[model samples]
Target: MTFRTRFAPSPTGPLHLGHAYSALIAAQEARAHGGEFLLRIEDIDQSRSRTHWEDQIYDDLAWLGLSWPRPVMRQSERTKAYARAVAQLTDAGLTYPCICRRADIEAAAGAPQEGVPQFGPDGRIYPGTCRARVFPESQDHAIRLNMAKAVEGLTELSFVEKGALFAGAHRLDAARLVETIGDIILVRKGMAASYHLAVVVDDAEQGITQVTRGADLWEATQIHVLLQRLLGLSTPDYHHHDLIRDDAGKRLAKRDDARAIATYRADGATPEDVIEMVGLTP
Candidate 1:
């Protein structure tokens, strides 16, 4: 298969140094392998997604000397696809509706059983309060994959990792997934789909052979792999690279406007300079 990768970013904020590093790394990898590098707009959360920020993403990436084929794949326009995937999972009895809010989960997890994990990849591993509840027709709720049900009969679950950390073949533990990850949200309330569900479906549709991103997302790869198996999608190779950090050694975020690519450009920094700042070759 032809090698393919992508740089997917939410247009809710500015593309910072970390974003530059990831995009450059993906584009560089594609070039080195004589493959294709794609850009995806992860704007599923339309409430925060803005046209101006999306425009700035293109501007900033172009200013950094990176280019990709257009028109780009925007998540907002792919809700029907996400809904279909959700419907498939639901029909297979691998999904359930969840009406529990954040506060409710916290209260339920307050008194945990001994040796039970308090957190997982999806943050505060779902308490499964709504796992046995029937799907309410008129009530608003999110959808969650039943981890235990999803992993049934699925042995030999693994993926290739080409990143710096954990660079090798890794197998997923089914029991660990149930205990730690729990039933993660596939579709969030008031949103078309959660990141986990959307990304897996999008990667398959885009024919992405490899997924490149920051190391912070390493833990979440297992979830994606599981979803791929459940959805009968192909699992891609993964490259989780180092993250760009601030002076204090913390990873850069969209909120860190000082480290934004646009800020550097405004301060008269060139594309080469920005690339060098992120420890990449021009």
Candidate 2:
């Protein structure tokens, strides 16, 4: 199969130094391996997604001297596809509708127990209060994966990591997943699909052979792998690179306008300068 990778960005804010580094890295790796680099617009959150911000993403990436094929994939247009995947999982009894709000989850979890993880990649691991509840037809609700059911009968789960720090074969403990990352959200209350579900389905549809992103997301890889297996989809190799942080050591976020690519470009910085700033060759 031809090597393929993608740089998927949410068009809710400016592209900062971190975004530049990720996009450049993926593009560079694609060239090095004679593969194809693709761009994806993760605009699933329509409330925050803006046309101006989406246009800026294109301008910023192009200004950095990176190129991808036209008619790029956008998450906004893939709701039907996401819905179909959710239906398949639901039909297999691996999913349930949840009406628990953040406050509800916190209250249900109560105090943190000894040796029990309270937080996970999906944030405050779900308490499974609604796991046994039937889907309410008239009430708005989110969809959650039935973690125990999803991992049933699985002997072992593992994935290959080609990152700089943790480069090796990694295995996941099924029992641990049930304790920590319990019943992650497959679809949010008002969204078509949550990041976990949409990403897994999108990667499979794009035929992405490799996934390149920041190391901060390493913890979430196991979730994606499990989803791939449950959906009968292919799991791509992953490259989790280091993140770009500010002087204070905090990772750059969209709010860091000073580190935004547009800011650097306006201050007379060239594409080569931006590339070098991210520790990449021009």
Candidate 3:
């Protein structure tokens, strides 16, 4: 492996401390191992993604003493590729239209099971309300992967994890994926594809040999595994690193503008301050 890694962030808002830590660690890892470090703009959500935020991302990373090659990858320009992946799954009988609303899926997932919340990588496990419906393209519906069928179609699956706690390789069970992940969104209404699908496709296309991200995405790897298998893509080594939290122990979010890298710079905080804040330096 070439130890390739990336720091992909959606340009919906300014880069926060959490984003900085992940980016810094990924770049450091690639450098330490003599590998390539890539930056990707996950700006597929055109409705929310802003060019100003993208510009801030560059400034933030540069201030943190990170550099990358020219021509960074942007998800917005790769819709056609994502569409082809979606079409493959749909034609292979592994995907169906999902027209259920969030409220509807929540109600169904919690139907008659109080106090036992159903959750997936993105929060609630979709109840698969429209998994069986073969709706017309004229109807407004998102495409969802048929987890049950998709898992059965694949043989034994596994992935590598480099996190300190769960370090080493990990094996994926087909039955657990169907049970825990349920059916996940592939393509949204009038969009290219969901984050799960786009990421799975993008990583392979980018030749990313190592995925260094937050531990919050560990569970989502199961869903990505299914997509990788379905699309015949190569799986990469995953390094789910620790998350950066505030004094109150809450994880940082894009809405936490006070913790934004740009804000810190304006407040007289140096790059060393950020490195120290994230405990990446002594």
Can you tell me which runs of candidate 1 are displaced by over 4 Å?
112-114
Off by over 4 Å in 3: 110-117
What is the C-alpha local distance difference test score of candidate 3?
0.87
Per-residue lDDT, model 2, residue 80, is 99
> Per-residue lDDT tens digits of candidate 3, residues 108-159?
7655466443776856778778876776778898888888888875777888
Q: Tens digit of lDDT per residue, candidate 2, span 1-282? A: 999999999999999999999999999889989999999999999999999999999999988888999899999999999999999999999998899989999999898889889999999999889888876578999999999999999866888988787899898889988988999999998999999999999999999999999999999999999999999998899999999999999999999999999999999999999999999889
Model 2 misplacement above 4 A:
none
For all the candidates, what are their Cα RMSDs to the real structure? 1.0, 0.9, 1.6
lDDT of 3 at 95: 87
- The lDDT values for all models are 0.94, 0.93, 0.87
Ranking by TM-score: 2, 1, 3
What value of lDDT does candidate 1 attain over all alpha carbons? Answer: 0.94
**Candidate 1 pairs with clashing backbones:** none
Best model per lDDT: 1
Cα lDDT tens digits for candidate 1, 12-68: 999999999999999999999999999999999999999999999999999988899
RMSD from true fold, candidate 2:
0.9
